[model samples]
Target: MPSSSVPSSPSWHTRVELPSDVPAVHELTVAAFGRPTEAELLGRLRTDAGWIDALSVVVTLATDTGSPVGHVVLTRAFIDDVPALAMGPVSVHPDHQRSGAGSAAVRASLDAARAMGERYVFLLGHPSYYPRFGFGRASAHGVTLTVDAPDEAWMALSLTPAEHPLPSGTARWAAAFAMP
Candidate 1:
């Protein structure tokens, strides 16, 4: 169920940066997730064929500390062979959770996607969290996942309602995501 309370914004610096920031971004992901797997996945996605240049975003504290407090990434995915985006593994430093770092990253990334003319986006994420960004059950729009997931956990968002609209089909990640 969606929370009755809106999430409070984090008090930190948030902006998008260049590929030169990839290392710091990876480190932030590892620290936030407490695992190397997501870091590895992000690395692979950087070189994947489906990667999109403008969709990656980084969020950091406002103090100019030169360290990222959170990160969010989106890459090209497909629904029924139609172009879309996939948001994943957004991470915020454990100490910074509820500070709005993660939400800032997500909001930035989605804004970037919309600016780039993307229509749809899919994500496997916290049921309670993503809806604040306009995400709804993928099945509600005829989208699904190859791997099993609860209906509430797999979600989709439409950035351009008039053009691509919402499509129904399996969400296919880039080849990088298929690697071990």
Candidate 2:
């Protein structure tokens, strides 16, 4: 595992999550959060209409040839009536935390989203941690959330800003989010 401040090594292999990877990803999510809430959310999202199989990413140690130690998901969300994506339930095995595995998974997911023509992504995450991935205040782009969270924790990223700027309006996460 790489430290948060450290860059992920080139040895970290990133790829889309496969059906065979589901169990490992679930266990990793549970281990990372020390709870099943996030994992449960993932389970629900998997069968939901918002699920995008290509946007689920995992990271493994190229050297070890083991199961993925990191995972991330970008599911269907919306800004106002416009379609968008929501990044969440990012997980890295506890044993692999602080290693660059988490970052690699995140980067891979975002890249996959962009490649698939997604333009906007919104999330509630650590302000300091997510900014490194080009996320900024969602409020700055007129994005709002009904969920109870600090102003700074709500962030947005424009995957293709030059072509399509970040949209504005209340973010509508997947039903599984159950945000009020």
Candidate 3:
């Protein structure tokens, strides 16, 4: 894990989350967040139809290892009947928090979304932390979620600026999100 002032590709490098990485990823997720909540949500996402392979990305200290030092998951969600992505629970082991691994995984996740023809990604996270990856307030882009959150904390990124613009509507996260 490497840390830089601005998020970079990370010296550790990133890869698509594989079945083999699940256990380590779960452990890391729990350790990073100090709770089983995120890991449980990931499990729910995995068994749900919203789990897109490309959306689950990870970063590791070495390519040969199945253990992920960090992870970022994006899942199928809908915005006004158009398909979109919901990003969250981006986790980095507590030991690697400041290391660039988390940022690297996030970058990889966004890149994968664009490559998959996804147009929009929404997230509820730190207002100050996510902008480096080009995220801005979701409301500003006309994207809304079905829950309450601070304006700045709910953010979005438009993958296809010219062809796909995020719309103003409720974002229905996957079943795993369990948003009431």
Candidate 4:
């Protein structure tokens, strides 16, 4: 899979896991971002009392010796008061760039969201990277952001068009994400 490659060495395995792996997930995020801001954000989100456990996905090495190399988190957000999922802060360790670890993490998170019956997901990220996951410009669906951001950077994905469909309104992230 494109999401499980090892860019330089071509010798790592990426697999998804449960919340018990938070510490390793944090380490991977720190290593990937070279800072604690993203990690802190994730920490705050996890304890916010509103986090949806089933939507959090972590990608780790298949072997016991392999440490977590990438992380992706999806949490409850809103579109004009309509419940939705927000994808963000996806991280792949510097050494693992182009290895597909980040892609795998995203794919896993999306799958989890679908299974949990979530219909819409929003993200403010690279205009390029997220399209492969069926994400498109949120503006196309009437979705907007409260804070200033590039229009192309804000995207959304709908898992069930028949039911909830896409929402049109301002995106509202959790309070933890709202903190500076």
Q: Kindly report which residue stretches of model 2 are placed more than 4 angstroms away from their true locations once superposed.
A: 1-10
- Full-model lDDT, candidate 2: 0.90
Give per-residue CA lDDT, model 1, range 1-180, as digits (tens): 886987755467667757678888887889888999999999898899988777777887776646787888899999869888889879887878888888889989998888887888999999999999999899988897888788999899998776666988878888888921
Candidate with better lDDT, 2 vs 4: 2
Backbone clash count for every predicted candidate, in the order shown? 5, 5, 1, 2
Q: Residues 5-122, candidate 3: write the lDDT tens digits.
A: 8665446878888888899989999999999999999889899889988789989876545668999999998887988888978999998898788888898899989888888888
- The CA lDDT of each predicted structure is 0.84, 0.90, 0.86, 0.80
Residue range 53-98, candidate 4, lDDT tens digits: 7767666655543467787888888888898988877988787777
TM-scores, all models, native as reference: 0.88, 0.92, 0.90, 0.85
Candidate 3 weakest ten by summed lDDT: 3-12
Off by over 4 Å in 3: 1-10
TM-score of candidate 3 relative to the true fold:
0.90
List of clashing residue pairs for candidate 4: 3-100, 5-99
Write the residue-wise lDDT of candidate 2 on 72-150 in tens digits: 9999999989999999989999888887888888999998998888899999998889999999999999999987789
Q: Candidate 4, which ten residues in sequence have the lowest lDDT sum?
A: 8-17
Native-to-model Cα distance after best TM-score fit, residue 97 in candidate 2, in Å: 1.1
